[model samples]
Target: MKTIWITGASSGLGAEISKQAQSKGYRIVKLARSFSTSKMENQNIISVHMDLLDENQVMKTVKYLSEQGLAPDVVINNAGIGIFKTAWDINQQEAEQIFRVNVLGMMALTGAVIPIMKEKQSGHIIQIGSQAGKLATAKASVYAASKHAVIGYSNAIRLELKPFGIAVSTVNPGPIATPFLKQADPSGSYENSIKKWLLDPTKVAERVVRLIETPKREVNLPWWMNVAAKAHAVAPHLFESIAGPFLTKK
Candidate 1:
């Protein structure tokens, strides 16, 4: 049986993935900051409460799993946060907070998992990145930067860890309707437009589960986001010209 450890399993994509993975008969270890007894009461699931920002807590969880002889076949870093305000609007402290949760926190957890996977000489590491990683805009500056870092981190480790039979892959999701949206809403006119474009969190989770279940480099979900990401890449200036105004507050 394949076993995978998935973080961000409290709700939204994480919660959905945990349940669906169980149905597919893959034993799951679920991690999150705030969990509900109602959500993860299944024999195939082990729930670990962790604040990714806390490196000590993260290390202990992985060490515990290893000692239990249940080191995972895969580790999915899915816990993340996004703040949509112009780089300056959010202030330095807030920006740092975003980096801590979205970047450092995930890295800390992955750092804990990789060595165990390396010792086993086989495993997959899937980082849940964002389409924002591929493109940059006014308000999403910090978020895009952090996700861009995920892309770099995953790409570099893919080959580095390959020698140990561990593969690193990332999923760049465009937008997903989750409780998180309520927090990131820019309080701008485009709110409805932005919400409409979101992919379902459950769908994102299902895709992550399947991608890890098999062997692959990376998978981009709701595929059309690729077009937008690339359009920005090829002609960032033009893309910015069109996206700048609406994306920024007047």
Candidate 2:
């Protein structure tokens, strides 16, 4: 059976992904600081305690997986934290934590797994990015920046790992109906504003899990969002000017 490693599997999209992947008969290694057997009632799922903020813990988790012959066939970098605030309003600590969890920690975990993948001559690394990364919006400066880094990193590694038979895929989705919004926008204003547009967590998870069988360079949810991102790339000023009111919802 192929072993799949998923971070942030304690809740939200991550949890949904785990449940769906397990149903497909894959061995799941769920990584999260708060992950517990009680929360994950599947005997086929292995819960590993991982605090991505600590590089040491990431290394240890990888080592344990290796020692136990659980080298992942696919590693999904799904763990992320976001705090929505204007660039000037976001504090230094919050900004740094966002990068640590959303970028550096993800890189550390992926870096550690690369060698194992290279040794096997095959593996897939999937990054959970955001549509905000493609087109930055007001009040989500830092959060968007972190996701932009994820996309950039994923793009580079996709080329570098191609010769080794490894694959890299990035799933960029717009606002999802999950606990993530509750934490990112504690005020609930943004959630309320984007209620109709919020992507379903289960639906997004299904799309993410599909990548394991048919890997792609990237998958942007809600086809229209992808179209907007492409349009923004071509004419940023025009897109921003026209969508200014919509962009400020966050």
Candidate 3:
């Protein structure tokens, strides 16, 4: 059985992925701050209490897992937070907090695990990205920035790790219906159109499983999202002309 380690396994996409992976017979290690895989948990499942924001605890946990020879065939960085706020409305502290969990924390854990995988010249790094990573939108300014960083970082890591026989991949899903949107702005300023298009977390999880099994360089759900991102990139003026007005609501 392949050993897989998944972060953010407590709820939403992460939790669904953990369960689905479990059903597939992969020995799973689920990491969450306060949740457990105890219900269906067994020796094949190890739930760890992890706070990615705490470097000391994060490093310690990695080291301990390493010492136990529990290296995984794949590590999924699915733990993240989303904040929806207009650029100016979001303060410096809030921006840092978003990056701390969504960006830096993922890096810390990846840094901890890469060496072991490198020694064996085997492993996969799966990052759960978003459509925002491909294009910037209003209100979700800071949140989109972090995800955009993830796309760039994942691409770079893929190039760097390819020669070592390690796979680096990311799944960018559009408008996922997770706690993210509900907690994003908290001011309820997000447009109604986008919210109505939210995709189920399980649907995203299913795609993730496909990514894990096949090991694609990168995958994006909802074909139209990729199309729109391209248009936004190549024809920014036009994209903004139509998209900008609706995105920024009072």
Task: Return the top candidate by TM-score.
Answer: 2
- lDDT (0 to 1) per candidate: 0.79, 0.93, 0.83
**What are the TM-scores, per candidate, against the unseen true structure?**
0.90, 0.97, 0.93
Instruction: Provide the global lDDT of candidate 3 against the true structure.
Output: 0.83
- For model 2 the local lDDT of residue 155 reads 93
lDDT of 2 by residue, 190-222 (tens): 999999999999999999999999999899999
Worst 10 residues of 2 by lDDT: 35-44
Mind giving the per-residue lDDT tens digits that candidate 1 earns over 148-234?
A: 999998999897898998988888887778776667765644456665677987788778878866767777766776876777788
Overlapping backbone residue pairs in candidate 1 total 0
Winner of 1 and 3 under TM-score: 3
What's the CA RMSD of model 1 in angstroms?
2.6
lDDT of 1 at 55: 83
Clashing pairs in 3: 84-184
Instruction: Please give the RMSD to the true structure for each candidate, in Å.
Output: 2.6, 1.5, 2.2
Candidate 2 residue spans exceeding 4 A from truth: 36-43
Better of 1 and 2 by TM-score: 2
How does residue 58 of candidate 2 score in lDDT?
Answer: 92
lDDT at position 79, candidate 2: 95
